[model samples]
Target: MKGRLVALVGPEQVELHEYDLPEIPPGAALLKVRRANVCGSDLHIWHFLSVAFRDIVMGHEFVAEVAELGEGLTTDSAGQPLKVGDRVAAVYYHTCLKCAACGRGDFSMCSNAVASMGAPPTSPPHFTGAFATHYFLSPGQFFYKVPDEVSDAAVAGANCGLAQMMFSLDKVGVRRGTNVVIQGAGGLGLYAAAVANRSGANVIVVEREPVRIAAARLFGAHHIVDMSELTTVEERTQRILDLTKGIGADAIIEVTGRSEAFAEAIEYARVGASIASVGNLNVGEKFELKFAPAWITRKQLRIVGVLRYDPWYLRDAIQFLADNGDRFPFDALTDRVFTMDEVIEALELSESRIVSRAAIIPV
Candidate 1:
């Protein structure tokens, strides 16, 4: 069999390439691509912002169907029965379960995990990216069968953004009646709102963009603050504080890519609170503001940095969508869709933030 892959070859350069798909080897599998999502990180890669990923395959977040399972592979990571034709989503990376990090079930922090996407084509099973007709999972890459109750649009982002949000919220231990402040209303922010809301937290989303503000509300944000209308950072923070009755946010999830957001995040959080920063991923981008080092120590705040997520979160993410798919506007998240041939244009649209979400159907 043969497969097609989209490769990020240079700055803002993408090309479709072909590869041969040998018979599924032991413990390996083949996924018939369904839908791959364009995430904020893809925008950076699309614009040629980093050199390490210049020659890597383009996408990492998607959902697929089990086209074929190889020798010794009949069950998913959770030991559930699995077979061809099953709809599924998987962790973006493969963990060497024997590593110290994996030994503790912290796959996201595993030093030995191989990222399925972003790997060079020189590696066998070159269909490492999801933006292709088929995706080949090398040995150790795990996947979970998605429940039929989940819609494709709702499950499309489960592997990346949704799963990461699950892990981020868990790290903060958001509980019932917890006042949560979301720093952005983009994909991750919206996901955070839904997740926190499901966990019985009151969510307040601060966003300047009108589209995302609307999206935040749809995603279950209890309070929406339009920063444009607020006028300044202090005013926006004060508005959030007011919503919490001046107690400030018990927890703040930073999903805004703006470097300055974290500086402001410190101001929004209450004493002895937590701040989980999953956004602000730009490399070498300088923050225009400054903070007092003593403030962090005085507050005794818990600060954590999230990378990807545990594979378990993928299953949890899919399940969350299945349960709440109708309650929130999951369908509206996918504002645009493109064919495999429109890869470049799709990236451009996503980069421009013209839509809340964009997808590539590679079937």
Candidate 2:
């Protein structure tokens, strides 16, 4: 059977290509995408800023249903029974167990992480990304079935933003009474806010956009540092200090995708504090850093740059939504929905910030 996929032809350009689906190999599966989200990383890839993803399939945040299970495939990564037509969320990246990183049990840092995600659409299977009619799951890929109580809108982001936030927060030791500051109020920031809040941390979000500021509050931010009012880094640092009772933040999360935000994170962090650098994926002179390395040595800060989470985190993200979906506005995160034909419009609107988040439903 034929399947269609959106392929990146150039910077800010995409084209729909149709090709016959390849046979599902043993221990693999094929899925029909039900809903896909346009995340901040999607924007990075759309602009050709990602060196690994140019001329490749265009999406990674999505939820799909099993269209066909290959021979010998009987259960999910968690040992749950799997069946055809079950809703599921798959980890977007690959983890080759034979790789050096995986050999040391650092699955998240697997050397071949983008093996499938960065493949060109002209290749066999031709369904590497979620912006497509079908997605091919190769052998060894980790996937988990979605719970019935969670809506597609709530679970679609579980694979990307939510899982990463959950992992990043856990990585930085965000626990009860920890003063945590999150920069930006995009999907990743919002998800970080919610996760930090649920962890019993004092959540403070730094955002400038009105809509996102309100979203930060909804997602359980105890305080919003309005960039409109406090326009300077020093002023914002004072506000953070004031909010933290002059101790500064115990943990800071940078999710603004702006290089300046990373520099500011150091200013907001207390001595011995940890910063989770989740954004700012681009690397070039344009995204250069001007901060001094002395600051890290003097303050003794822990900075972690996370790209993808361990595959098992997706399972935890699903369970998190199933347990707390009602406490936060997970469904409202997607402000706009578009069909396959409107993929370009979806990308444009998301890029222009006309929509906080966009969803694509394959026709």
How far residue 296's Cα lies from its native spot in candidate 2, in Å, is 1.2
- lDDT score for candidate 1 against the true structure: 0.85
Question: How does residue 301 of candidate 2 score in lDDT?
Answer: 97
lDDT of 2 by residue, 96-137 (tens): 999999999898999999999999999887899999999999
**RMSD after CA superposition, every candidate:** 1.5, 1.2
Regions more than 4 Å wrong, model 1: none
Local distance difference test, each candidate = 0.85, 0.93
Tens digits of per-residue lDDT, candidate 1, 1-363, equal: 788889887788888888887478999899988999998888887777865466777887888999999999988877889989999897887788888999998889987655556578656778887888888877788788888888778788999999999999998878899999989988899999999999999899999888788888889899988888998878987898889998888999999888788998898889998999899777789877578978899888899999888878888888899899889987678889998889998998887777558999984
Best by TM-score: 2
Candidate 2: lDDT of 192?
95
